[model samples]
Target chain A: MMCYIYDGSFEGLLTAIYETYYRKEHPNKILSITDYEKSFLYKDVFIDTDPNKSDKVYNSIKTKISNQTLKHVFHAFVSENEDSGTWIYNYLRLGWKVGKKLDLHLTDDRVLAIHNITRKVSREIHYMQGLLRFRKIKNDVFYAPFEPQFNIVGLLASHFANRMSDQNWIIHDVKRDIGVLYNQEEWVITNINLKGDITFAEDEEFYQKLWKEYFKNIAIKNRINPKLQKSNMPMKYWKYLIEKN
Target chain B: MEILDKLKILADAAKYDVSCSSSGSSRKNKKGGLGNSHISGICHSWSDDGRCISLLKILFTNYCIYDCAYCVNRSSNDIPRAMFSPEEMVNLTVNFYRRNYIEGLFLSSAIYKSPSYTMELLLKTVKTLREKNFNGYIHLKAIPGADLNIMREAGKHVDRMSVNIELPSNNGLKLLAPQKSKEHIIKPMGLISSKIVENVSERKLYKNSDKFVPAGQSTQLIVGATPDKDLNILTLSESLYERFNLKRVYYSAYVPVSKHPNLPQISTPPLLREHRLYQADWLLRFYGFKSQELLDSKNPNFDIHFDPKCNWAIRNLHLFPVEINRADYEMLLRIPGIGIKSAKKIISARRVGPINYDNLKKIGAVLKRAKYFITCQGKYYGETKFNEDNIKNSLLANSSDKLNITQGEQLSLFSLYPNLLPLPDILTKITGEL
Candidate 1:
């Protein structure tokens, strides 16, 4: 059985799919570089990153299937789940067979699994848009540090660009070590490290105190349900939140 | 005074007024504007009580002129007082919005000096936010008896405005809040409703005329405070929605903060009762159930054990055993535990072919409760016959109690065990009756 190995990038994964169709040979499984296995009987076919092949697959999906379907597949790719490769493969396979209306078949497990991952990623992005608290730094640029469970650092750029159009801001995902920096005109992605001696705005402490006070006082003491708070705002995001901190 | 102290006092005073919706409008951010309103709204945080903290809910002041027996901020009560200037309010809103800490501002105020005076301050704050090009959502409370012109002008700059009818009945208002009258409250609501209608027709012709409360209006009714039954409250809400074209009717379970003679003899707010009222209200708004349909004169209040939809479905059991694949959207909605989302899913899925029990589960329908009311193609999967007590006991047996309702008179609000009742879960999901 042949095992197709890609470079752990979305484009590389697409190129592998292109090769599977081009060679008319089905692999036993598709895997990324990090999850490589060494064995006796497994034939390893390394997939080189080809932009032309990836673009062909991308355009074919937008034309042959649906653009909305492509978005769901891309969102599931960034979900970084262990079952993502197989489920997305099955989803695309079913999507191509059912034409544009594949999304309506909720009974299909592959389609259901892909939608679930897409929901998780989108939910995380939406929650981050609310939970991310920005603090002004020395250069008058706003910086927020968070550690989301999913790799959605690049997904939040367009939302903040539309909302905070007048200010320069940075949203840093500490776990992945990458961040998006926006300067009102455009946004750039870079690997940023800020655990060392990050400076704050002069009145940053004062605002933080006020926000904590508001969060505490807004709760009805007669109706204190700590379990509910924990369910909505889980403890994983607590250390980065201003009030939870 | 320090800003932290002011926030503590104002936010503490404002906690009892439970209207935390940040939805209904989709105002885009102008090129120079600082923020925009999302169509379905966004929730920033959840308080310890499981209530959503969407907007920056705070009163402009805690000082008041009227003495209401049930209120903590009445003239007789000696609570610490603080107020924010219009400019300070604008600054706080803009900064918090930029930091993504809130959806917008929910600015309510006490009647300092007079109702008009308090409304003028709220109007100034919202107008300044608009003039400064901060396009975030703002839900301003229109003080009853405020000048009509000032209220209309305030509506121009804000997304939503609510004139709370705190007490449902006239006698309750007279006994508890002698300074307030039912007539004074409804006057502003009527005017705002007419103005909203006028603005819609005018904008249709004029194209770019400034919007007047583009998200429309809503009001709140404090439940469990007086002896009014759920039927009276639901009937009033039904009329409000029909007469005023109201966007929503919020039900805040009365949290007993003051010791008063006229109030009910309860130490804790009736959480289950309040939850039941919200469930019935959802049926009225979304499920197309009328006030008379959910309850009758024989039973003025909703059933404490079962939800309103479940109760109604059980009573009309002849309509049950509906074929999931063949049922129309409205017929599917009548089945217990099937919400608008799952109903739409069933409709779309059936178009491809026949559906079965596994497909129903995949569509996110609450199969435990829906099983008793529906059949898949030709076969029924329900355990109990068409009987009320049997279905109710089975539903209770199946649920894991999402809410922490407990037993006895102490009525602890912090219990983790779920007799489990908070219908619709969140306030903004009021459109989804399930």
Candidate 2:
């Protein structure tokens, strides 16, 4: 049995994948770099964090697989699947041997598992786009806070930035303590500290009033099924929705 | 009054209008326009029932002079009613747009004071949003009996407009809703259609002419309320699309709220029936299935166990085992598991090389479902029996055990006794060929 340790980052994982392919050693087990101490009497190899090796692997992936495939691999990594480390090792080994036709073996169980995880993460990212309802604060900046099931805050930035290009808005991933700030033309992801009280301008309140009215007015009393409504727009998300209040 | 109170009342009233789609238009941002509508569309929110809330669907007023029995906002109902000023609605839309909370407005209204008066308020709201706020992508509801001038003015300002053909038949309307007449609804729809055609032709000659309801028109029909079968409903919807140049035809399942002697006392909403109708509707629009082909006098409803397409394939077993290589695009679309995308893929891939079963999976065909109906080259892998009854029984047996167990239970009696079943059940018996 052989244990390989990689630096705890996406690039580090890519470098590890590169080493596994180059070494050509069919290791019985693969472990994260942080789990080095946990390796029990196995042949352990500690990989030095190499940016050049990571870049080479990324380039090879970009050339061999489509850009979409590289993105799927990255998303699979973010999914934090329990068996992903081993699966990534095998996937890369298979891709290196296949040479630019990796998707041909997508029906293989191991490849399909990775693809499924990646698809789930992608779906979560889309769901959050529709679910993330923002409120306007005093400075014409829109503010929204959410605690999504997955680390999808980074994925949602481009969607909002493109859709709400003319307006200034901030979508805060409250749990992760990071947000996407869009001002007129450009948008950037930044760390935010929102522990203190937040306030909106009088005009913001005026608009909120109108939105609240709109939300209330849209529900048909004849079809007022709170049970059904709770299923779609959960009570957990109501705190941030303007109408829920 | 404060805008919040008005929002509550209007949102509640407008919530019943089950046509919240903001798609089928590709309007771009003009030099000074605040927003634009994408053809693929954007859904701003998904409501509790897992339905997408695209536009800010709200009514201008819940105070109605016409007392439709099925409506909560009927004049007879003792509920608190409210109306939004044109200025208030425009402000709400602008503010909401700035906050990234909505795609656009889905402005609808009750018959407040008079049909003309209600139409005027709706027109003013869209006008304010377009002219004063410079907002774009508005979908206004044309009042059924409103003045043609008001409807025309509405068409000029908004992206899309709809006049609900609430009940399928005039008799259904007479029994359930007394005040609304078939002519009142159909006449305005006809006027809007002609005006849209005129605008398109005029724009061809004069390139700078203003667009009129560029998203086109859509209408909704309430299902399960009247005695109309799925055949009747689908036939009418087919005519509406063919004649009106409609962008979409939405179907809302009737949820009985009133304890009227006329209505049925049902426990759950007819969601499955509504879903089947929508599936049938899609078949009519995208797939080459006609309404008459889907249902006839002998069998006038969709199969509850399987989707309309799957049911159709099972019934017509003689048509099955179509060779994927030789099958035309339309024929490929008729296969149970092959959607438009998959059919196109098969067509494209076959041009390059002969495709087998493995290659079909690569193109995203649901092999489990398609396996029964399709052939690769000359080899047919479906059941050896190859009879309609055997194929249907096997398909139903396999499908009933899967996700649609409850639906199977609801439809079991109909599948057994087609003629003796109720109208709803009879409709569920005939499979639509989408």
List all candidate RMSDs to the true structure.
3.6, 5.7
Binned by DockQ into CAPRI classes (incorrect, acceptable, medium, high), candidate 2 is acceptable
Task: Give the TM-scores of the predictions, in the order they appear.
Answer: 0.94, 0.79
Model 2 lDDT per residue over B339-401, tens place = 997898777666646888876886689887788888897887766477777667767666532
User: Which lDDT tens digits does candidate 2 get at residues A3-97?
Assistant: 77776677788777778778877765555664447647788777776899999999988887667668767787766655566777777666667
Kept native contacts, fraction for each prediction: 0.72, 0.33
The ten-residue window of minimal lDDT in model 1 chain A covers A81-90
Residues forming the 10-long window of minimal summed lDDT in candidate 1 chain B: B425-434
For model 1, residues B224-316, the per-residue Cα lDDT tens digits are: 777777889999999999999998888887777788877765555667767788878778888788999898889888876678888888888
List-wise, what DockQ does each model earn?
0.60, 0.23
Q: Which candidate tops lDDT?
A: 1
What's the CA error at residue A13 for candidate 2, in Å?
5.1
The digit string of per-residue lDDT tens for model 1 on A194-220 reads 667789889778777878889888888
Model 1, position A77, has a per-residue lDDT of 85
DockQ score of the complex predicted as candidate 2: 0.23
Instruction: Please tell me which predicted candidate would have the highest TM-score against the true structure.
Output: 1
